[model samples]
Target: MAAATFIEYSKGTQFVSTHIYGSWWFCMLWGALAIGTITYIIKMRMHSATLLLLHTSFIVILTGALITHLFAIKGLVHIRKGITTNQYIVNNGKEIKTLPFNIRLNNFNIIYNNGTSAPKDYISYITITDDKQSKDGYISINNIFTYNFVRLYQTSYDDDGNGTYLTINSDPYGIAISYTGYALLFFSLIWLLIDPNGSYRKLLKSPLLKKGMLCIMFLCGFSSVTQAASTLPDISANKFGKLDIMYNNRICPIQTFAIDFTEKLYGSSSYNDYSAEQVLTGFIFWNDEWKNEPIIKIKDNTLRKYFGLPKYISINQLFDKNLGGYILGPAVQEYYQGNHDKLHKAIIEIDDKVQLIMSLRHGEPFKIFPYGKGDNIIWYSPKAQVPKSMDTDKAMFVKNIFTLLNQSAHSGNYNQFNSLIAKIRIYQEQNGGNTLPSVTQVIAELTYNRIPFANILFMINITMGFITLLYSIYRLTSIKNNRHITKIISYTSIIIMLLSFIALTYCEILRWIISKNIPMANGYETMLLLAWFVMLFSLIFYHRFKILITFGFLMSGFFLLVSHIGQMDPQITPIMPVLSSPLLSIHVSIIMMSFALLSLTFICGLTALILYVTHRIKHDEKTIIDNQLSSLYLLSKILLYPAMSALGIGIFVGAIWANISWGQYWSWDPKEVWALITFMFYAIVLHKKSLPVFNSPLYYHIYTTVAFAMILMTYFGVNYFLGGMHSYA
Candidate 1:
């Protein structure tokens, strides 16, 4: 499956799906596994219903997949407005299939975000005619239309909105079986967690495990230094930042926009002493001076050397005065003409940065002045063209508002500038009205931006986490027993972590309120949520497994670090219509929680390995090392039951979501394949009798430590290296 993902990138989904996943050999492999599982269950005389059902569910799911591969008819159909279509193309356009009913596209509509051109949803109204009987229905992203055992999903639409394209699936038996399997899997997992006779429960009841748990319970708890002052006039930039504007398909405070804009251009939200708002104000009011500021970051060494530019280059530096044109103009042209080598890609990237700065200089992103009424309202920048039908006075105000504000700022007339801002706010309220975000939401977002808790908390978390981890290890290893002092230190660390977790939770709530959606839509948001889950789980289980608190701090801190690394956008924007389902929230939350558990297991494995390598214990002290290793292995085993189950459940939940949104349960996308691989790879540790090596503490820790690589590949590697539909996550 892993190899298939990379191969699919080159050969396309159809080729890989046909030759790899859908091949006879793949089906045979699944058949062999199913047969082997049943044989093993019979040989071992396994009678636990939850365990039997859990293993049986995978066989059923595989059978469903095989049936789907053999019998499902998946295709696409494009229907023009007022035209009836019964034929669809399938098998990568090699075969055509006819539906039992004719679908006539009655209308196609693109629903836009309030005060913005960004599409919120695509709806296609259609009438299905079958045997002289007709039914009217609508198909949308997550809302599918079914008729005569056929499903139609909204795929795309014509640019002119006169036609619509939909994905068609006719797989009644396969989907039914697969969904049954999913339901069984879910129920069995829940049952296993609570089952009195389950391995997990049995292990927990063991005296050795209880004694080990009790024995360990006491140990529980910059990019650049550029000092460039803002050149904007000394005015209330904070007030300006508070004003609401249409940005990135949603209405948010300009404070959010300013922070994102500054970070995009300068690689940080602040430049020396000036705030993001101040820096943005400078660019809008003092374009010429700001253009010469060396704020644009060029991280590519080769690209920098090619242009003979510094690490951070000014907008003016990108313009070749000698040639009287943009320096990257010729390179960009070559890039468009199919010269897509590494250098060209880098050139295009730098060109995009330059273009962003140029857009700011032209005031293209300042869409603050709302005009028109109802659903037709549009937020217009000063440079945007105004309709002639608009009220003359309103149109004039929209055109001259920025110029007036600039003049007031240049003249240092604070009163006039403030008044102008107030007038614009009034104008927005009048035009934008209820479509605009509430003042409270605006204030919350502004406060959220100002806190920067993720930035500050990450550093503190890592520092305190390291200290606690080392101290805990020392206490566990050394003969010294300074219980009083260690207890004080542990409590202090716990208090700090509790405070940090509260702060993170508060910020997440504020973000959720501002976006009006769960904060699991993108990589940055999901990473933050994952960090929160780690801390949450740690706090929940730290009493029993005290070292988890230290691991939690380190893991959460590193997750935050990954979120901030590279070019992650921290902006809270609206998610696509397909992602607006409640199932998506549940799916991502479960997955993130599972990841947190898996992360703790990895840390346990690492700690055990460190003990094995760092300390060559004498015969007298061998018992201590063996006991510690045994405890670590037990901790990992306890974590694996839930971690593996959650991962399996999360994957299937995601499949259900995909089925609802895209007319297919599994597309074998790189992320999906890698996730499956991770689940199966880790499943080996659970079968200790079959894989007896895992019975040994040393081998168990080694296998788990290495098994963590699959988790990393599934989460990070799939996003960065193996691009897929789930890359947004």
Candidate 2:
């Protein structure tokens, strides 16, 4: 599957689906697995209902997939408004399928958010005419319409909104069977956790485990300045930031725009001693002075040299006096023309920043005044073109607010400046009406922006976690331990981590409330959620496995760090229409939590490897080293059960979501294939009897530690290298 992503062998022929997944060998492999599982269960007389059901669920799911591959009819239907259609195109237009009924598109509407042009939903109203009767139905992104075993899902629409494209699927039997398997799998996992005789429970009951747990508890004790100051009044700038504006197709405070803008150009939310608002305000009012401040970050040394610019190039420097044009214009044109090698890609990035600064200078991005009415309302900056429908006086006011505000700031007329800000707010309220966010939501978002909780928490977590890890290691290796000191350090570290967790939780909640959606829509948001999950699971199991506390802090810190990586944008934006489903939230949450648990398992494996190496070097007591290794191995096993189960359930839930939104349960996208691979590889560790190698603690630890690469590949590699349908996640 991984190889299929890179090698486009037999390009555009459905090579992967036909030659790999749908091949006879693939069916034979699944058949062999089913037979092997049943034979093993019978030969061993395995009477555990939870275990039997869990294994059976996988077989049933595969059976359903095979059924779908063999019999499902998937196609696309495009219906123009007021037109009836019963035929659909399939197989990249190589085949046509006729529906038993006709579907007439009554109307197609692109629903926008209350005050913004961002589409909230795409609704296609249609009348289905069958032989017996006719029925009216509506289909949206996640809302599917079903009739006579055929499902219809909204896929795309004509730009003019005269027609819509919908996906059609007639796979009743396969979907039913797959969904049944998903349900069984979910229930069996829940039962396995509570089952008194389950391996997880039995392991907890073992005497050696109890003794090892006590020993673990005992050992727990161990552990930019360069930019010139903006001359703008900080107070007024901040006050201006409170006023609402339309940004990224949503209504938000100007502060949100400023922070995003500043971070994009300067690589931080603030420059020198000025806040983001002050810096941005300065740029709008004092473009000549601000443009030459050399604040824009240019990280590529080669690009900087080619342009003969410093590490931080000013806006003015990007325009060459000798060339009489933008320095990057030629390269940027090449980039647009599809010359996207390493250097051109970097040029495009710098070009984006340059373009953003230019936009800010023209006041194009500062859409602060609401105009028009109802769903047609548009926010206009001082420099934006005014619509003819707008009242002449209102349009003039919208175009001159920034000019007046700039004059007021220059004159240092505090009262006038304050009144201008207030007037803008009032104008927004009058025009934006209920579509605008409530005052509380705006305040919450402002608060979220100011705190920088993720930034602070990552630093605190990494530093404190590393300290605790060192102390824990000391306690582990030391023959004579200071119990009093260890307890104090352990308790202190836990308290700090507890506080950080609470802060992170508050951050996520604030983000959720502000965005009006769950904070798991993109890579940055999911990483933040993953960090939260790691801390949550760590705290839950801290007592039984004290080492988890250290792992939790470290993992959470690393997750936050990843969220801050260059490619991951930390800005909070509205989710796409397809992501509005409640199922998506549940799916992402479960997947991230499972990832957190798997991360902990990796930490356990790493710790065991370290212990083995340390014990060998020191020639430590055989019994003592073995006991430690045994405890670590047990912890990994305990984590594996839920991690593997949750991953499996999460993948299936995503499939169901896909079926709802895209009219197909599985498309064998890169992310889906890699997720399946990760699940299967980890599942091998659970079958200790069949894979005797895993029965050995040393080999088990090594295998698990190495297996973590699959998780990394699934989560990070698929996202960065192998583009897929789920890349938005």
Candidate 3:
């Protein structure tokens, strides 16, 4: 199944996915598994009816999915306001699929984020009518409408607000059957967990387990950690560092603003220990590449054929009193001298990465025509190479401000420079007409030192997790009374995990307060929340199952480390329109939490398998290995129940959200299909104990370790490799 999913992902086609599942041999294989399962149940009369239904639910789900593949109708309907459309595009725009009913778009509207044009939601108001009935409704991402067995989902809208595009799917027959299977699967697993015959009920009854659960519950409450308001400083410093300017729709201290600006331009926040503010300051006033080397030395001559005629030009030449008389002409050199207004007028935008550098260079032979008849030619005039979409006023403001900055850097005129920054702040507020605060532009330097605790917390998590794993192994193998020290270290690790959890929760909340919305709207925030869930659940399960502490620490530490990578750097940004649903927060939390639980289970399964293999080879410590294996098997079992259940619920909730937002509950997008596959794979693993042929503990461990690949595909593969409706995730 993992191989098939990867193949489908590589192909980037839904038809390829259907081909894998809809193949005759695939059906036959599933049919055989179903028949064999039924036969075993009938012959053995399994002790648990819930187990029988759980196993049978797979067959039912496959039946529904196959029905969808063969009979479902999926297409796209694009409509403008007051326009009625019965035909929709299908087969990748090759043909038209006509619905039995016609849909009329009454109105299309979008809700924008506060003080910004970024859309928070896209709503399509529509009415559907057939020969027998008529229905009027509205649809948004996560909100859908059904009429005459067909579903409509609002997928996108024209930026001009003149048209709305919706995806329509008619798979009434298969969806009902599939949903029935979904319910049965959900209930059957819940029954297995709580049933008198189940192992979970036995584990829950233990006094030690119950007490441990209480402590875990207490620790989980740290999710609500809060912080006090911060006070801003008003003092003499870098003037540009004090002025606030908005970037990426986030309001922050100028120090933070500089970091984000540099990140966008240089693809990193800092270089050679110089913070973004330092880089920006140097770029504007002294020199951009502030090193011993001559800035902007035209050493790469290419035979010196591009420019009409020029000796080596260095930025140092600008300060040479004779530059205006020595260079190409006075008109160009005068701008580089003291004519701040003239220099500002010559600035123009070229690209986002070189916004500051390109604007500073302006007209002095900086434009390189890299292709065509004038390839590699350097244009001396700003008008010869300026982009049509350049915001001239913004460029001018930046240039004039930087010119004052250069003078201040040269003569130490701090008061004048500071006043100019304050004056510019007022000008930007009154005349800039930007949604974000003008203060965001202040050239304050910032580094990772601000949140040293966050760094320390992550280190504690990883280091403690590693130490606990080592201690856990020592406990497994040692014969001495190390319980006291082990307990101490264990408690200390738990304390650190608690602190880390609180710290992360605080950061997430602070972002929510600043952004005025839930923080799970992006990848970084979602991953952070996942780390919290892993720690919380691991701590919760720790008391009842002490082995989980090691696994939890290792997994949480690893995931948190991944979250800290530069790519996942948690920068506060605007949420996309489709992610504006109220259900988005709940939906993402459930799914991420489910993945965390399953990750711990995967670790337990791997440990069990290793112990079993080691026991077979050594033959010396069979008893100890068996004891460890028993505990691990039980832990994995206990963890899998909730993991599978949560995944199932999350998938269904996502479908409901999809229907509300897109108008269809199921679209068989790569991500959606993989999620279903993951749920079913775990369901089959749950029934492993019921079937004698697969009752061995080895099978249990192997199945779990392998089935985890499905979750990996659903979470990572779908996002990076497969094309899907859930691509926004």
Candidate 4:
């Protein structure tokens, strides 16, 4: 039973994929999809043994994930502090399904948060069990217990109050996730110098080798493409049990019930007492039938038959649990009233702190009157109760859904709420109704419990890609490119640009199959999406200025790589805190555009350095043949200048975005540092006097390598090691 987590697709189309079987076995789908993906890669007519081998690791990763989960347990073990006797807690660690047995915790410890809200530490001593046989052990974060196939992460606490709170967990899929991670990391390593954009020596003297390399490049791309496959479902979103969410709609017994200020305090703030009116935050459990409505009689009262409300009391008789009596606190005098119509228009004050406002009347939802002004309320409730339906309201349909919800709660099938509205419209139509299931309920389901932290797959793969990119640049400088080298650089950049653009677009669109109005939340996602925009612009601008095209491609690759790596964030996590801002999406999109544009400048700078070192240039030959060719010096002179200009403009626009989002012109964050560094490198490359220690071909390649390294340091290194604003996971 999933607690409360995203049950279906987020609004974005990038992270979640659609499957016909209605199972969230995306990990499983990835395995099967990997097979088809393998076949597709082979069929691409792109055959290079090197490329094939380079990407084979990806297939291995898929194999690894399949093996780890289906055959082994790869989950985390939590450790906390608490116990009468020093021991361990061993659990079968299965979720939804009942775990096989319990592993006791012999001992546990806490690593306190040293600084304000900083990191803490955990250590747990645990013991494993199989029937009567048992063994003792202790585990911590990044520590494992292999015999029972368990990995332990110092996760949470279990306080026994008497200074004892220790707990631990054993995760089955933990190893599988790790294997997938390493597989991705390995793929990036192989891809760095071997893929289309890598720094491999272009042995194009042999046309056969060139063609073979082409095939290899395709294989690499093919491998990357497979990662887009789906995996396993933990009974999350698709199916509905007794009262799956499809049948419940948004109606639940867990209403945030509120009763207005019962009494106001009479004295000063220091010695003030307040009275509160309480209502059921919980749904009517078991036998309780809240038949306050004349038209409805929904009850399963056998649960708490004797539980009944006390006599309905006036404001003076309201209970004051905090103050031990009905006396009001000094600061609460403002709530003294007879009919408290304004109370229904008030925010809840808990322990004298402001909380949610009364957004409805008794048995009815409130009209959203803004802090002081608003005529835009969609609907307002007259009383705190369900509104009477219209003649075509399909009351029976509503009743059925609520019944399902009640039943699901009774049966303890929490995930069934994942599809409580399983047959909303069909029943509605059958019973005479006009409204159908909203798109949110048509196919997708969401519950916060399904995932913990952010979508981590992006965090690892994208980050690893950047590390590989840096290594690739290192490889690039050491290799000598003959005449064919230029051709490969020119051709590969263009082809990769095309591929990147398509892949980026597809990634962006895949976000929302069920449509929960969420964007790609991870930093990796933002980077990729932003890079696509950047490349799209580069492709457009590069076509206008030939030099800029090569420059822009390099820039796009750098930013995209960094973005991929920056997706890793361990400290930060995914929080759906109901971000209610109308301007957020627009502001974010604009910032993304700025990132892409700035990226274009970075590309130009790298191209300028590489061109300067090579000391020779070749046109597409097909385009400028039969004409007096411009000298290499003249071309380099012209290209570097424009490239520099583009870089500057991109940075300036990026500054504008920084100001709007963060309310600052710039922050010395890692990604920002790299952006600026890239800008400076290009600017210097344009000026003769500022050239680095090397001016020859070798030096040029070396500079290019260093420049891109700086890019990596800014992207992945900064994100991973140094940390920065862009270090979002």
- TM for candidate 3 is 0.73
1-729, model 1: which lDDT tens digit per residue? 778888987888779878998788988988998999899999999877888899989988988988888899889999999999999998777888888889999999999877777788999999999897999999998998998889999999999999999999989999999999999999998877789988888778867666655345336430045655335543578879878888887888888888887887778888667788888888888788788788788878888888788988888888877976798999899999999998899888778877777787677998888877788888888888988888889989988888998898788787898898899888888888656997778878878987877788789888878888788767766777687877787788778879989999998898888888988888888888989998998788766777777888898998888876644645677778899898899899999989888988888899888877756752337777787788878878888899988988999999999999998899888988998898999988889877888889989999999998998898898888778788774
Give all TM-scores, in the order shown: 0.96, 0.96, 0.73, 0.31
Please estimate how well model 1 matches the true structure, expressed as its whole-model Cα lDDT: 0.84
The local lDDT score (0 to 100) that residue 530 gets in candidate 2 is 90
Q: How would the candidate models be sorted by lDDT, starting from the highest?
A: 1, 2, 3, 4
TM-score of 4: 0.31
Candidate 1 clashing pairs, residues 3+ apart or interchain: none
Residue 346, model 3: lDDT of 29
lDDT of 4: 0.37
- Give Cα distance to truth, residue 554, candidate 1, Å: 1.3
* lDDT values for all models: 0.84, 0.84, 0.62, 0.37
Clash tally for model 3:
26
Which is the better candidate, 1 or 3, if ranked by lDDT?
Answer: 1
lDDT per residue as tens, model 3, 458-550: 677778766766565544444564545765776776677777778777666665665666877765667677777887887786656656666
lDDT of 4 by residue, 184-280 (tens): 4444444543455322323223343334432222212111112221211224212321121111112111111111111122111111111111111
- Name the Cα RMSD for model 1: 2.6
